[model samples]
Each structure stands twice: as structure tokens, then as C-alpha cells.
Target chain A: MTVPRYTRLIQSLPASVPFVGPEEQERTRGAPFAARLGANENVFGPSPKAIAAMQAETLEIWKYGDPTSFDLRNALAAHMRVQPQNILVGEGIDGLLGYLVRLLISQGDAVVTSDGAYPTFNYHVTGFGGIIHKVPYNGDHEDPAALFAKAKEVEAKLVYLANPDNPMGTWHAGTVIAQALNELPEDCLLLLDEAYVEFAPEGTAAQVDVEDPRIIRMRTFSKAYGMAGARIGYAVGAEGLIRNFDKIRNHFGMNRMAQTGALAALNDQDWLAQTQAKVSQARDRISRIAGDNGLTILPSATNFVAVDCGADGDFARKVLAALVARGIFVRMPFVAPQDRCIRISCGRPEDLDLLAEALPLALAEARK
Target chain B: MTVPRYTRLIQSLPASVPFVGPEEQERTRGAPFAARLGANENVFGPSPKAIAAMQAETLEIWKYGDPTSFDLRNALAAHMRVQPQNILVGEGIDGLLGYLVRLLISQGDAVVTSDGAYPTFNYHVTGFGGIIHKVPYNGDHEDPAALFAKAKEVEAKLVYLANPDNPMGTWHAGTVIAQALNELPEDCLLLLDEAYVEFAPEGTAAQVDVEDPRIIRMRTFSKAYGMAGARIGYAVGAEGLIRNFDKIRNHFGMNRMAQTGALAALNDQDWLAQTQAKVSQARDRISRIAGDNGLTILPSATNFVAVDCGADGDFARKVLAALVARGIFVRMPFVAPQDRCIRISCGRPEDLDLLAEALPLALAEARK
Candidate 1:
């Protein structure tokens, strides 16, 4: 059979999805999930003020959002204590990652990331035909030194790290990351993902100067602001680095309500503090529940907590399946060691109550 | 002076914005426009049902949108009379264009479009280092035969065409485009943009078999559906071609409220028809206004009409400037000949009355 023509690179690549959303699983099961902790989405929801702002802007959806995202950028700059020129907002951190990789990785260029760190970054690099040099995570933490060494060894143009990271819910101190910055390859830039940073402790975020071109920090409203459905996120870096996004981005990809909603979300810091307190309380509840069930709870600096299932990857997989069967949706790390644990996002009390009732029964069923 | 490091390509590229938004212009002038007709946004707004749907969804904004966009896809499939597998929803046609380019065009890969076609597509191609080959429009129309010839000449992997096109508001019969498809280069695929199809004559949109891999049709709620800021669009193509987008798209980019809004928008055909009637009346009024001022209005199948100012591109530029100075936001084409005209979007009567009131004085001032 003859194939329709595609570029050599595209032809060589396999068509694969990065993540199977919980919605797809629900569709297949013909049932809605009892608890949605799989995607790390905020259960507390966006601030009421943000919702009101977005609702007010709904009738104005006929107009395009500001291509520059000026209002949102100015608000973000003020909130982050950085100049507006240093901020670049996009569809989300995911969209920003795609742009960042496109800006740096050329065909055949080398890039580095933790072996299982955000697969979407690797997808972008590979889509551009960039060669990937992955360093395995050291223990549960992403080893920045190993990533830096790999970058220098492969002469990589970019490196990726997630602080208060996903999957394993592990974190490295901001000072440790700052120290690691010194060892980064001279020509390589670090893409520091802080998607969960608002839920992280103070100083857990790196203190790199906004003028430093060697690093760009990404943050999202999806977690702390509880506006995942708004698809708003921003990157902060040196002006020169940030400006490059304009050369390639979809100038109008941003939604207008997202701009309005995100601005209101930023303005209502009281709601954010409330969400943080809720997350903190929920985390404790999750830890207690896991401990009572004889599972080991990993230390978490994120909105989610990872629990070691006291078994291998396959047993953990069984537990995950059982949870899903019992109408609880959760996710796990993809690789070894880390795969022995399941990640549960902090949920509302009702959702957590559902999880608490289901976990013991699911574990017992999985053991059987 | 020492400069911080960047990837070689990043250093080689100039920082440029593809579009300067109306908001930015307003901010610079310290005032908003009296009439918002510049960007072709539908001032009449989305269906009340759609707005209500979005407002109701604001409470659910804490949850990440279904990554698969399952319900919206099902609704769109039913509305488009196509199978679910043949459609891929994205963050407007702009986001879909980026993903399609990533799937087909590689570094140095050739691409073709009309000389003054959509700049966002050109931006994406250049961002990927694709070699651009432009075919000038035959008169004001995007000549299909000319586009096919250019694709063959450059051995391009992709060719772009927008029916009921932007900037000029010209269109070709669907039969003409369908006949031209057979002449496309063996390896090339045609990207048919039907963004304004909702306002166009019934026969203007080409009817193609969804199983045909030679072409893909893009549609958006950002036009006649009056939801530009919703950021929702979809492409219909062969299943194999559509599935390839999964490899590169930001799967979770679809906003939750946007999905609800679009579904509601699609279900409200009566509102759409009412919007179309308003658009037609507005277009007629604009033409009459242009005729009153001794300007020739181009026949339009779009919500906007282009009026030839009976002078050179420079004079048209002055006229646009004078109108903007009078708080009338308007835009013109970038190329020669076409640049002698300015495009105005359909707006409410009062907004058009403001345009009417400003045009004569602006013209006299421009002449002086």
C-alpha cells in the first residue's frame, strides 16, 4: 500500500498521545469518576471573583483576545515583582514549552531532561527532530547536576526541570537549584517548570534574577488559582529571551475570558491563600489515610501527595486499576521505582471522603 | 558589552509581533475606539445560549477540560455530518495550523500560500525554518491554479487557501476549488480555511469526502458564530491525517467553558441565521456609506467589506490614520493595489453611525 507523503521526520515518527486523560477512561467505563485526583486539577475551583469576571466577559467573546495579552501580562508582572517585558503568557505552560523548545532546538540538536520528566517537552523536541539525552531521576528528585553534566556531555542546547515536581511529588530546595545553575552548560538554557510552585513552600522556587538569560521559569494558574479550564500560564525570563516567543507564537491563541479570569484570579490573593490552606489540610488527610492503609506517603511540596504502595510497579498498577474500577481516578509515575507509587491530588473533603472509603476496599481487592 | 547566551537560531531571529492588537493601539492613544471594526471581530456577539452556557460552566473552571474534547467533538461531528474520528478540535484554527505545520513541515521544507495570505501561518512556517514560496493573488482572488502551480514549482508539502478570504473578502465557487484540487502536486496537501463560511453563500464551501487525504477543511467559532474569544476551532480530514495531530497538539488546551460555549453555539442555528442577517444589513449599509463618499465597495461574502478609496496605497494609509485619530478603528491590506482599500467589520448601527460620521471629515483632512 502506498502512503500519502509526509516529511521524512514525520514519517519516521510514531503517532502517540502523551497522556490518556481521565475523561477517556470514564468514557470507556461508561461512568463518571467519584473522585478526580488524576490530573492534579484543583478541586476547590477558581475564585468566585474570577468566575464573575469571566461570566461578565462571556457576551464579549465575539472579540478576539489581546494578542499581546497586555492586561494579563501587566498584572502578572506586578504580582511576580518582575517587569512586564520579562513575562510571556500563552495557552498554558504546555503551549509555552512547545514554543520554548522550538526557539532553542534545531534538527539534530541535543536536549536534556529527566528520563520521566514532563513527556510533552520531549514530544516537542522529538517533533523538531532534536536528539534527546535523558538523565534518570536520582531517588525521587530530579537530579539537576546529572542533567547539567548530560547537557555538557552531549552539548545540549536546552535542559528541563520541574520544581516541586509531578508524578513523584518530590522537590529540591531553591538554594540547591540555584547552586546547580552554576554548573549548567555555558550555552544551554534551563526550562524551569514551576506549575505547582504556588502550593510549594517559600524559597522552594529558585531565586534566579529575571535578567538571567540562562533560565526561564514557567508557572501556571491551573493549580493554585484553580483555573485549569481557562488555559492561562506565563513564563518569566530575561527580556531578550522572553521576546523571542513573539517571533513564533500564535498571537491570538489566548482566550479573552481567560485573560479576564486570570487577572481576577491574581487580584484575589485571599482566595489563593484559602485554597492553599485547604490543600494543606487535604494533604494531611491524604497522608493519614494512606498511612492507615499501610502505604508509605512521600513528602509532598505540591498539591498532590504520592503514596508508595509497598509493592512493585505491577502491584501498583493493580491498585490503580482497582481504584479506577471503584470510581476513583488517580495517576502514577511512568518509570521504575517511582512507578511503585500512586499520585493523589489534594481534593475537597467530599472527594477525599470518597477516596478514603474506596482506598481500603480497592487495596484489598488488588491484593486478592 | 557582553551578551547572555542563546541557541544559535534564537540569536539569528528578530523579535517581531505578527499582529498589533486594537487594545494596544487604544492603550497607546489613551482611549478606546468609537467603532470596533478593525480586526473583523463580530460585534453582534455569540448566541445568548452560548453565553449562558459559558457562564454556567464558570463554576466548573477548576477542573481541567476533557483533554479529548469528547462531547464537543461528538457535537461537531454530528453538525458537520462527519464521523467523530475525522475531527480534531483545537484552540481556534491558529492552534490547529501550528500543529499541522509541525506534523508536515520540517526545517527547510517548502510551503506555499498567497503573497498576502494569513501572516500567522507564515509566522509558524518561519518559526519552523520552512522555506516559503508565495504566489501572488490573481486580481483580488486567491487563484487555485496559481497556488497548485506554486506548490509544484517549489515541491511544497503544504498549500493554504482561505475561501471568503480575509483582508479582501473575495471568494471562489466551490466547484472551482474542487476542480483545482485534482491539479495539486502529488505530495502536497491543501489547507482549506473556511473560517467565514457561515456568512458566505451556500455554494462557496467545497464539498469534499472526509476520507480524502489530499485536503483538510478548517472551521471556527471565531467568525460568524460570534465567539472569537472562545478559542475553539476544528479540522475535518481523513482519520489517518487527523490522528497525527495527537503527536504534537497540547491535548488539554481546550478550555472547559469554551467547549460548553461552542456546543451551545453550534446548537443555535436560528441565532446564527439572525447574526448572518445582521451582518448582511451592515455590509449593505457600509457599501452605501462608501458609495456616498465616492469610494467603490468590493462585493463581499464576508462580514467585512473592503472599500477602495479611489487613491493610492499612501492615500488609503492617510485615511486609515485620520479615522484612527478620530477614534474609528479600521485596517487595510499590506500589498500593493489591494492596499488602496480599507477593510471594515460589521458592527451595531450606532458603531457604524460613528464610522459614517468620521469618514468624510477624515477623508477631507487626509486629502489636505
Candidate 2:
């Protein structure tokens, strides 16, 4: 029974999914979700023009997308006011993170991320056999100072932070992050995941010079742009760092429609503005619903809100399960304290109305 | 001056493009191609229905595609007459190859392929630290006997073959492959890339036996279907092997529009039949054109034809260069003997007319 050998690292990996879909849970529960509020996907949807462009491009699905993503890159550079060299587009932050991890972290290389930050990033780092050093979150937000300290102590090659972060829906000012960058270990590179940046305050994102090689910023069309299904995201960094992605990226990996749709989405700022207004309105609705249920909603500059359940992690888990049972699809944080809250994505008025209706019943049921 | 420390493997590898794209070449030459025949893309285009489906899906680009790819997989399974559990849909054949290589080939593991079969497959194995053993082509076709012998000798984990192959436009009959499959080492998996199989002669594709663990058949929408840009491909294998991809794949990587376009493409066998007819016509036209130029055209079942210049590889190189210079983009084999032939993809009548007009001038120039 001799079998083909997998690499040592691959062999060591457990065949596990980072998250299960709400759809799968529903099949088990024997019903559909009353409110699709998990996964942090934009419920506001993409602009009509962006959708039209993607739909139109769909007709040409027989062709491979431009390998260089030339047109999209050119458009993005103009929009960002940076050279195309400053950006590298990929299949969402998840794909880019995997490539980056492969590029910098080999077996036993030191990498640092906040405990219970983005699990997918940790998954990539671990998948490559990098030795992960987890620093605890300072309060509910990812702590820049603690991350820098740990990176220096471990002599880490990479450090990760998510501004306007997930699960907790908390953020740090750009100035705070910039200060941390200045104190980073000379050999350490900071991976700034701004997947939710478009939904954050103006100065939440640092204005670091593109020439600075110490930091790479990741942004996504998945958030406010409501194109999560498109799987389009990009990284902005110095030319030296940016060019490294070509060493291993799937050169023709981008979907044709996504490349075209993203370009169109970027150009339609009016739609983005309109979506932002919807998101704002939805956020208020989520907060009000949580308050009505006597739960506390954390301040959020993200598309999702983390509502504190006024209980322990276990108690909050019960509430989340009850919500799922009651046809409300919601998720909570993985770590304690943070897990004392449940996360909900902003959706349509009707979707929030469903959430508002179910939250009270679910909470009462959970308590019983 | 300090930057993040890169992994040893990253440090060892040079940032190299295995194959330069036509677009990049065009950028260098400062003009677009007159006849885009290189890269073996179907210039005849995909089904009108596929295009229409994609266009319709474009409006929903913001929604991430179903991670399970339920509809597409079920449709593909029915098309292949296999259980959906036995199929794994991916970004494309390229992406799937990369994943399989990563899964099976560890550092220094032996893997095998024809010397010039597909560089991208070899690139994936090498990128994952697998040692590649190349068995030269038997005549101008992939040498099945030699491949089995080499795989056995090296105890290779994977062996890759492209039927009705690219660059050479040749194929091995399904019976020949089924015979070789019997000799593969118990743990050695055969990755049969049947990208061009749809256009190949009947009995060229191995009869689907999804339960066969020894071989995985890869198919793509990019080639005969004309949806290369859509980034859709699928692999059919035993359930165990197919399920393993879920352990590590980006669950949300599928683009919604791509799924729609691919589904529609699969359903429209009428368009597929028409495209095959057009490709056959284009192949005949190309061969006749080559014969008029005192060159021999290789017998081709694939959408592309390989024309032998009846001269050295150097002569073929010059003719290719001349064609590129004149804005008729085409490619040749990378190694000797085969390199004496230039590969031309099937295109529309006008596109082939451009090739016909350009071939003589290019040949004459090359002769000079």
C-alpha cells in the first residue's frame, strides 16, 4: 500500500474549513435563514452599472482574462493616484495572503498576528509551516503596539493587523498605526488588511508613502462595493515588494467578469456613496434592534456590527445558536470577551426587520 | 535598509515568468497583434447562450459564487455522467494543477511529465519543490510507454499528460492511456489534462469512471468552450481525492458570473458542436495554407494546427518572429525538432486570412 508522498507541511495540515456556510447549517436545521447577516458580505449589492458591465463581460466568458490585468490595473492606479506598479490584484485577500505567506514564510520562520484576528491569514501562515506568535488583542481591537513588541521579540519577518477589523468591529486611528510602523523591527513587514477600509473613517487608513517597503496594504471590493462573490482584491506596496507576487501568483487566475466589474465598480463612486448611505442606515437599525433586546452594539466603522450580549462567551454562543434555530443566520467571535458578542452584516431594510423581530425571541429562548 | 526576511526557497528561486504573454510582448513591440493566434485560445468565441448567461450574471457580480458550486457541479457531473462528489470545479486547469501539485509533491519528491508537454504544470511541481523527470516525446506525441517507465523508475507521485495536446496538436488514444494507467504505481496519480478533448476524435477521452483513484481527468471551459477568460475548469476523480481539495481551497474563490457562464456553456452542446465544426474548417484552411507555402502541417484533432517549416528550428523561430513583427501572433514548440513547427490556433475566417497573407511574407523574410 505504498502511497504518493505529500510535502511534510501539507501532510501535517488538518483537512479543515475555516468557516462553514450558513446554507449548510440551514440544511441541517431544516429551514432557511430569516436574515442573512453573517460572513461580512455586503447585502447592499454592487452598482447597476458595475453589474451591467459584469453581465456584459459574461458574454465573452469564453476568453481568458487579460493575464496582466492591464486595463484594470491602469484604471485602479488612476483611481488610487498611484502607479500601476504600486498595486497587485489577486483573488481576494485570502488568495493574496496565501501567496504572500508562501513568499516570505518558510518552515519555522517567525510570524506574528493578533490572537483571534483573521483566521484565514493565520491558516496561510501555518499552512506554510511558519511559527506563529499570537499577541492578545488590546481591548477588543487589534493592538499595534503589542504586535510590534511581539514581532521584535520573536524577530518576526511579518506582522499582521486589520484596521476597522472584523468579529469585533473595532478600529484604531491611522496615526496610531503609523507610530507603530515607525517602531517596527527593521526586518519586520506589517501586513495591513483594510478589507473593510471603504466603510471606515477617512483617516483610519494610513497615508504611508508608496515607496515605504515596510508595509503592504490590502483592500477588497468584497466589502462596501458588495462584490464578495467576485473574489477581487488587491495589495498596494512599494515596487520591490509588489513585484514579488509574480514569483508565484496564478498569472491567469482572475475571472474575466470580476476584472471588468471591479474596474467599473471603482469608476462608479456615486453608487459607492449610495451604498454607504444604505450601510449607515442598516447599521443604525442593527444597533436599535440590539438595544431593544437589551444587548449592547459595539461602535463599528465596518459593514458588520458586533453586538455585545451582556454575558460570557458561552452565553453568547447560546444566543447565536438560538438565532440560527430561529432562522436568523448570525456568527460570533472566536476568542473570549470578543466572543461575548455576535456579529451581523448590514442587509436590506427587510432583512434587518427580520433580525429585529427574531433577536428578542432568540434571546428569550436562549435564556430559558 | 533592512527588509523582511524571505524563506530559503523564495531566496533560491529567481522571479521568472515561465512563459511571456502575448500582451507583454505586444507592450514591448508597441502594437497589438493583427491575428491573435498564439496561446491556443478559441478566437471563434463561445456559445452565444454562454455569453448571454454571463452577461446576465454580471449584474450579480457583487454576490460571491456558491462555494460548493452546487449548480455547476451537478450540471458538470450529469454532463460527465459521474457523481458530483467525484468532481471538483476550480478557477481553471492551471489553478487545479497548482493545487494538486501542492497536495502530492513535497520537497524533493519525484514527479514526471513529457519534456515539453506543458511548462505550467512543471512550474507548479517545481514551485512546490518537486523534482521533475522529463521523458522526451515519442515521435511528436507524448510517449505513454516512456512516461510509465520513467514514472516507475523515479517512483513519481504524479504524471501529467495533455491529450490532443497544445503546441504540437497531437494526442494518444484513450485505450493507450487506459493501458498505461494499469502500470502506474499504486500511489502514483495520473493527472490527465483533457483540455482539448471535446474537439478530439471519439474514444480519445478515457471513458469516465469516477471511482478510478489512479487517475484524475482535468477539463476546462477555456478552450473549445471559448470561456478562457471566465476561469472555469473541473477535475473528475475518486471522491476521496476530490474532497481533499476542500481542506485547503479558498472556499469563496469562485466568481458568480463565471459559474453562470460555465453552466450555460455546458448546457449549450449545440454551440459546442458548431465551434468544433468551425475549428475543423480552420484547421483544414491552415494546413492548406501551409502546403501552399511548401511546409507540412501536422495532423491535428485539436483546435490548433502545428505547421512544420521543413527546415531547422532556427528557421521556424524566424518565421514566428516575422509573423509577430507583422502583428500575426503565433507560438512554436520550445524544444528541438518540434520547435521546427509553429502552432496556430483556430480563428475566424478573416483572422485566418490574415495568417494566410502574412505567412508567405514572413517565410520569405525568414529565408533571407
Give each prediction's root-mean-square deviation over alpha carbons. 1.7, 1.8
- How well is each residue in A1-368 modelled by candidate 2, as lDDT tens digits? 53445566777888887777766777688887777788888877888878888877765565677778888888888877789998999999999999899889888999999888888898888888899999888789898988999999998999999998887889988998888787899889999999998888889988888778788999999988889888999998888888878877888899888888888889899999998888888889989998888888999999989999999988899999988887888888999878889999998999888888888888888799
Q: How well docked is model 1, in DockQ terms?
A: 0.65
TM-score of 2: 0.97
TM-score of each: 0.97, 0.97
User: Candidate 1 residues B180-258, lDDT tens each?
Assistant: 9899987788999999988999999898888888899999999888999989999999999998888778888898899
Query: Which ranges of candidate 1 are over 4 A from the true structure?
Result: A1-4, B1-11
Clashes of each: 0, 18
Residue B279, model 1, lDDT: 96
Best by lDDT: 1
